[model samples]
Target chain A: MRTSITRNRILTVLALAGFVVFLVYAQTNWDAYRLRILNLCAVYTIFAVTFNLIYGYTGQFSLGHAGFAAIGAYAAALLTMSPEQKAANFFLAPIIPLLRDVEWPFLPALLVGGTLAALASLLIGWPALRLRGDYLAIATLGFSEIIRVLFVNWQRITNGSLGLKGIPDHTNVYWSWGAALVTIFVVKRLVDSSYGRALRAVRDDEVAAQALGVRLFTHKMMAFMLSSFFVGVAGGLMANLISTIDPKVFMFFLTYQIVGITVMGGMSSLTGSLVAAVLYTVFLEVLRPIESPFDLGPLHIPGIPGMRMVLFSTLLLLVILFYRQGLFGQREFSWDGLLNTLARLHRRVTGLWGRTPPPSTVEKGEQ
Target chain B: MSRKKVLLVWLTLSLLLSLVAAGPVAGQEDEIVIGVYEPMTGPQAAGGELTMQGVYLAHEVRPEVLGRPIRLVLVDNRSDKAESATAVQRLIEQEGAVAIIGSYGSSNSMAGGEVAERAGVPVMGCSPTNPLVTEGKDYYFRACFIDPFQGRVMAKYAVEELGVEKVAIIQDVAQDYSVGLAAFFREAFIELTGDAKGIVAFTAYQTGDQDFTAQLASVMAKNPDAIYAPGYFGDGALLARQAREMGYQGYILGADAWEAPELIEIGGSAAEGILITSHYHPEAELSPASQPFVELFMEKYGERPSAFAALGYDAYMLVVDAIERAGTDDPKAIRDAMAETKDYEAVTGTITLDKNGDAVKDAVILKVEDGEFKYVGTVKP
Candidate 1:
């Protein structure tokens, strides 16, 4: 047992070392475009894990992520944009008096945006958490649409449909990956606590959990608000990375994308979300040629413009159909699994090289 | 386990290596790369395709500048704001383009503008008419007139030529172009008539709204002499049909967005008498230098060029002319040359950029006659 614990510690140290090495190498060697794509992957990882916390563990079907994101994006954008930019971008109507001169640095603005989104989610969750199944889904969907419409018409604050431009390019590898790591750590800690067990119990059997004196609404609200806060920060990072945003950027389709990621990864597994986010983000950029004109030898084929989404959906469908429980199911990366597999491989190699070892002898040796 | 980890690391390394290899490689330094982004699919595709046609033809005419071949890198923005931003970044960074031209929709152009401004790469819009697109951004410019000028021209045409006193407006609130143009038109029209009640009614609908009878019902109740509907062709057609069917006989005035073949097809005969202000019309006899371009466009595409096409052509020619004047492939130098442009002959008209980097030119007034936009006259702005 002591050896196993030591092995686990060694593996964790090695994993962390590998991560640091990757960060140093990427920061030194990558070009602007590659670095931007890497940062986007990190942002998506945070978003995906935050979304999983609500839909996976809490068993809440929330579809207002885009709405919350839109709030965050606008809050951060308005807070960070210079007063001169606000005047210029809002040339038609001119920005509202209060927000015209309000400019905060990137970090404070991002924190404020997340806090505002969490408060907004708390308000939305008051009425929304009472419902279940598709009813809750439709209500949340309507909320997102309302948010988009309000942003579009509220010209003084949102600059109307023109959206805000010239948001400072502040997102980088450190900020994005740092946020992603913080999210994973917090969510893992939460899921291990007693509160997390109650949330899961509600997810599995709401009525039975209610009978056991679990506060369903409070547990759901906690998960919802916490998830929304992280999602909001992720949105702020995305706006800074892209350097612009509009109401159209947070369409219902954006929520659908989040849902797709949460499902494709195992909803119950943060590691699955991390891996899926990286694969999805990198592959989206890598598969650009399929939607673009490219010379492949002598076969000159005109690009199908929207082929990326088509191929992406088909790949997603294959994953869901083949693996019912998703990539990692409800399981996570464990040191025991690694150690057991390593022991079996060692025994097999020894058996093949010299004298064959009995299974009982191999078990004794491992002990 | 360690061997498997080694194999995994090898696989990841090879993948990263392949991606890096697929990135833009260093080619001959003499070829000047120019990037163009447009929506090839989605709601605004027709406008994007028309603009691209003009740009391609312009490229065919002048493919060399400063004794170096110009290579055009065209990217599809998919009519999405985020995609538009990424497209411009890819153009400037990964593609190593010196100057960029693009984007039909005003919102999409704004997205591209943010990226170009941050990267210090110059981007010229072909048909984005929003004033904010180029405002306060040194790196962003446009070859088309802004919404204020277009709106004033249409309002002048309505009051003087069409002889309209009272008017109603239906704008697409979701579209920045439509809302901004409508506001400008309302201000100009009210000033011309010298009465606050000159514009009797104002209503709005979101983009993708198909049923406009409700909005039209309220608009018709005001008993206005004319209806100013500034929106895209899809909504424009349905509004015209519905307004005419509801027995409102006043003229329907529109903006440059109505210059499309699909407008006539969808609106049919109901669109016959609609008046619109445009960048160019086939029947207008302006510069003789543009005759060859018009003929070539008609011969190649089997149709007359729309205003977007003409603007696209003008934008491309202007960029190439700036590159020639700069005598260097440097982006900042090209930007200076582009800003110094004066009275350059373009297919649309003689183009001279004002202090705000907007073209100071004439807006063509066209009336729908016999399923086509026939030239009436031109209004200088």
Candidate 2:
């Protein structure tokens, strides 16, 4: 009971600390462009986290996350844009009466997009659940490719890859981070619950889980639908942040990149996934400036332009080979642990000087 | 328990280490930075690399602009729309680039344009032929003529010069460039034919699609007088070879994106008699500037220059010329100077920016025969 209480206190302190730091950082350095990238990272965090809920936790390989994202993006885009803007952008806007009159507000449109994506996942999941491993990957890949092809050919709805533009820019860091935080909280709670254990059991041994009264297909389908809902919400945020949606936006490479992040972050670890999302985004951003060839004094080094990706892929491969459990594994950061670490370092330095540490450090060191 | 503490300490140390990794970018007042954002890797890498090479060479030969050393900061978009947007933002906010040049693909260019316009930076595109790039945005401009005019020019060439009555289109549906050009071509072709049903058949393939057999079979069945495939030269060349192998005897025509060295190299003997609309022709020495630009490009790269390289050169020269005319890095003043640009001797042609920020230049028609793009003539669009 005491250990549990201490754990809860540590978690609360850490959460509060993180929230304070995020608020300070976001306010101090928040420009439209930086906010835009922050919003993107938040959206992808939600995506990666929800994707981990299924692929990482439940051990289902899905390559159709982009398809669900596309569905949500197009639905949200079509719903939120003013009728006049839609008419101006699309020639066939007036042909469909339901679409012509429909201009749902941003939040409701996002929910509606999420609902549609969930429905799509349910529909696709019914038959897809029968397959396993490589077959399942292939089916999901084909599903995404088909969705892309349909979005391209269905000019009346998607504008035929000319893309839906002039979407209202309503996505902000508050909306994105708020949604991501709530999603992470809810998913963490769910994963720690009995339901999550059952899901994992199904993942580990399907037949045994079924013999133990777990409904395999239903549980998997539920997880898939839930994952799709969060992914859809992320997509809605993406559409608003970018203020545009194209078939090209939902390319297979995007799904692969997220998958790479998932592997690097350690499957089934929510904290790992979140850290990976931020790390990946920031790494790409920072490396972009230094990726080119530069000259320092007498050295005229040729710019190897695409060397960044080579480095990233190599790092990813190394991570997979060496640190297979990823950076955090299943563990999360706690403030008590951090404070204790600081206290211990202070103690070590004080010991070297043959003196007592400060009261604050001693207090933390006792914990 | 101690293992967990050690892990926590490691995590905290790493987090702190990330902070130490951050560095401040020291800028020199004497140097002018120009940001070049393009798809340096991915499907559009070839085109972007060509454009970058052109810009790099331009900077090498003429390192100083307005008596300040010009530095080119190139950022890769990875051919993704979101990355392109972020790249433009970084270029404007972090690099403090006075002017930006980019983004060969239409979608990528549009993504970059949003950020550039919002940041109040002038983005001179190398070869993004979409009219929408500068339709309403004052900050966005390109060296190449818009696709609508290019489409109309090709339509007129096919109908009036080649006397092709029936034309078919096989475009890359995923590419806004190909789709927009195809639409314009269809509109112009139908208007020129005076009949809505003038096109024999229209088909499409997705970008990065290797097999064109199914698409070609459908187009070949129509047996049109000419086949127009407005896609990147890689896929366009492959389609040409595939169509010929499948017994297509009609004239193959393509848009400006089909002007690459790989088209001839990949299509080989099958590339013969393939006509394409382009902006530059090394053989067509329209102005005195063309000779020196071509000579310098060949001297540096040791290969014949593609239209993309020429446009990249022109885009840089136009921005530099505007900067020289404005006598300041003020975006609005530079924009005004860009609008006032006329008879600017570029490697591509003598350029004049219209009120809409499009280049008013002639389009050259070239045909591949014996693995070389022989310049036919120029069409004033």
Candidate 3:
């Protein structure tokens, strides 16, 4: 047991050291496009992990991620944009006087955005958490639609649909990865606590959990608010990284992406979320070439538009069909699992050299 | 063991294929590269393809400048702002482009413009007519007039030519193009009629909304002489069909977004007699330099080029002209030369860049006659 603990400690230190090396390498070597993609991967990692916390670990399916993200994005954008830029972009109607001259740095804006999202979840979770399964999904989706419509008509605040531009490009690898790490650590700690068992109890059977004195509403609301806060921070990072945003960017499709990532990453596994985030982001960039024409010597092959979506959906369908419990099931990657796999392979290799079949089996083979 | 071998083979093959498909190595001294960013795939693909036809045709005709082959590196923006910014970064940093042209939608162009502005590279927009696109940017320019001018032109046409005193407005609230144009049109319409109450009704609907019965009912009750619906083709056509079904027979006026063939295909018979203000019309009188381009475009595509295509062609030509005038491949010099453009002959019209990097030109008024966009007249700004 002591050796196992020492091994785990060594692994953690090594993993952190590797991550630091990668960050330094990326900072020095990557161009702007590659760096942007890397930053997006970290931001998506935060989003996917938080989404898994609510929908997978807590089993409370909510489709209001995009609305919460919009709240956070607009909050961060409005705070970060200079007053002059606000005056320029808001030509249709003037911005409210309270927000006109407001400009905060990146960290404070992100914190405020996350806090606001948590507050919003507090309002939404009160009524919506009472419903179960698909009804809850529909209610959350309806709220998201309402949020989008409100943003569209509220021209004085959101600049209508024209959107705000010239947001400062303040996001970098450190900010994105730093936020992602904090989210992962917090989520992991929460899931390992006593309340996490209560959440699982509520997820498995709400009536039984209530009989055992577990307050389902409080546990679900905790997961929901925590998820909202982290996802909100992710939205702020996305807004600042791209440097422009509109209501269109926070459509229902954005929630679909988060859900897709959480499911594809094995839902309940934090490590799965990390792996899926990097894999999915890199896969998207790699598939862009398929949407572009390429020349193969004498032959010129034209690209088919929308082929990326087709291929992506097909891969996702294959994953869902083959792995009903997701790639990792309810288990996470551990050094013990890796060591067992290696030991099994070693035994097989040694047996190939030394083992002989029994006489009864040999006779059966001959027959 | 065999399965592992197969996987290894597949991985090696994929790696080899990727190496072959990678972009060209940097510092190709013989070719002077110019980047083109467009929404080659997605909801805006049709507009992007039409606009690209103009740029491709211009390249076919004039492939060389300053004794070097001009190579255009094209990247798809996916009709998304974030992707557009990344595409622009790739163009400036990796492709070593001296100048860039692009982007059909105003938002995408504005996104790309921010990157180009930061990188000290010039971006010439083809059909992005938003005034904010070049408002504070030093390196962004466009070949088309902005929404404010276009909106005023449509308002003047409806008030003076159609003799409509009262109008109703339907805006697509989710789209920047729709909202910006509607705001300007409302302002101009009120100024022309000398009364704020001239706009009898103003209603709004979101982008993907197909059921306009409620807004149409509200608008029809106003009893206005004309209705202005300035939006994309899909929503605008549906709105027109719904309005006609409701038995409101007032004249329908539209803006440049109505110039696509989808308007006729979707609106059907209701699209006829709808007057639109656009940047280019196939039947309009063309300058001598524009005649060959029009003919070539028709022969190549077997269809009349839309205003987006014409602006795209003019954008490319304008960039080439600036490069020639600058007498070098330096981006800053080309930008300065582009800013000094005056009376430059383009396929759309004679363009002169104002102090704000917008073109001061005339807009064509079109009518949907015989299931096609027919030229009615021109409105000068």
Candidate 4:
């Protein structure tokens, strides 16, 4: 066990080192299109990681990501926008006096956006923490819709449905990936703590956890607040990265995508969420040609739009059917487990072990 | 089954799938690639598909430019803002397109315009009438009249022809184009009457909202001379039907977005007397380019082209015309020549690009009658 822990730490250090090198290469060499996809991967990584914290660790099924993200995106976009740009965008309806001349740097704007989202989550989670399972999801979904509608109609503040153009392009690979890493690290540390055990206990059996004095509401609210803050920050990054936003951008569809990511990645594994988000972002980009006009032999298959989404949804369905426990299940990535399995396979092939079966590294205790 | 086996199988399948995917990245060398980024699928799919048909028809009419076959590399924006920007990026960076033409929606055009502007590639827009699409941008150019002109044309018709003094405005707040046109129309109508209270009621609804009884009830209670509801054809038809059912007798005026045939079919008898400003009328051959475009479009598609199709055809022709005048396939040269466009005749009308890359063109008013669109007189800009 001691050796395994050391090996895991070493592997993590090496992996991070390799990632830093890759980031440098990407920033220097990749074009705007490639870098955009890369940035999207990081943004989604933040969303998925935060979602995994709420839905996976705390077992709270909330569909209010869209609302939180909209708040963050609008907040950041408004704050970071130059006063001149704001005046130009709100030509139809003048901006409110409070926000007309306000301009903050990207970092402060993102932080404010996150803080606002956290406050909103506190208000929402207080009442919503009472409901469990599907009811919570429905309530959160309704709240998200309300947020989108408000953004649509509140022309004075959000520019209504006309959308804000020329949002400062401050999100690059560094900002997105840095935020994603922070979210993962924070969630990982929280989940590994004693507080995390209480949250899991509440998830596993809420009545018994309450009997054991777990303070279910507090734990759930903690997870909810933390998750929303990162999600909001991720939303701000997306607004900057896209350089355009409107209420339509935060429709319930955005929440659905994050849910799909969290579910497709293991319901428990942060590493799975990280990997799945990147895969989702990249595969969406890489699969573009499949929808483009292509000639197969003598038959010309004119490009069918929306086919990529159809194929993607079908692929997602297949994965769920085949791997009912999700790709990672309750397991987390570990270097020792992988290396030991590879070594065992090698020995089996060489017949050096003389038919002695290697021990399985799959964690026996399922949360 | 052991979990390890499932993981291994999934990993192996993904690797194989990626290997298979690598086969489809072919390069074009001889073809002059003009990238098209439009919403091929989503809420705006109908408009995008119709406009692309015109682009296809025009490509068939004139397949080559600068002695090279024009290959239109189209990327679907999926009616998403982020996707629209990336679609433009992919077209300019990966596809090596000389010029871009796209984006039926104003929001889409604005989003894509930023990327194209940054990349220093010129984009020719089709039917995105919002001023923001081409405003303060050198790269984004459109072949369609802006919203203010469309609004002004309807306002002029209401005052000079119909003599309606009181007009109520109900706009789709969800759409930038609808809101913009409605605002412009209100401004023009108020200005023409020189009365701040010329507009009786100003109401709004969202896109994709199926119900409008409340809006109509409020609009009808005002007893205005006419109601100007600038929105997409779906909403326009719905509003017209609801307004007539509510016993509102005043004329219904809408913007060019109501030019689709669905308006008549959906609105039925209520659609009669609804005056809509259009970019082109198939029967009204205003320019020499109009008749041939109409004939070729009907021959190819077996139907008269919609206003969107006309704008699409014009956008394509204008791009190719700029390429010819520039005497090179270079994007910079094409942009320079396109910026210098004056009195360029296309299917839509005689277009001269303004300083902001907006086309100056005349508006055509079409009235719905006997379940058919009849051409009224043209309103010169």
TM-scores vs. true structure, each candidate: 0.91, 0.91, 0.93, 0.95
**Lowest-scoring 10 consecutive residues by lDDT in candidate 3 chain B?**
B18-27
Q: 2 or 4: which has the higher DockQ?
A: 4
lDDT per residue (tens digit) for residues B237-325 in model 1: 99999999999899898998888778899999899998988888767765665788889898879988878898899889889999889
RMSD (CA, angstroms), candidate 4: 2.6
For B173-205, candidate 2 gives per-residue lDDT tens digits of 887778888888889999998977679888888
In candidate 3, stretches whose alpha carbon ends up further than 4 angstroms from where it belongs are A303-314, A321-324, A338-367, B1-15, B23-28
Docking class of 4: acceptable
Per-residue lDDT of candidate 3, residues B260-359 (tens digit):
8899999999998999889887677645567777889999898777788898899999999999999999999999999999999888888999998999
DockQ score of candidate 3? Answer: 0.39
DockQ score for candidate 2: 0.33
Specify the highest-lDDT model's number. Answer: 4
Candidate 3 residue lDDT tens string, A1-367: 8888788779878987899889889978988878988998998899888888998889999999998888888889999999989999888889999999999999999989899889989988899999999999999888887888888889999987788889898999989999999999899889889898888888888999999999999999999999999888888998898888888888888898888887877978887788778767776666655555666687776655555556667556656776665545566767766666676668768888666442231111000
Name the Cα RMSD for model 1: 4.4
Judged by DockQ, which candidate is best?
4
lDDT of 1 at B236: 93
Judged by DockQ cut-offs, the docking class of candidate 2 is acceptable
Tell me the docking grade of candidate 1: acceptable
Clashing pairs in 4: none
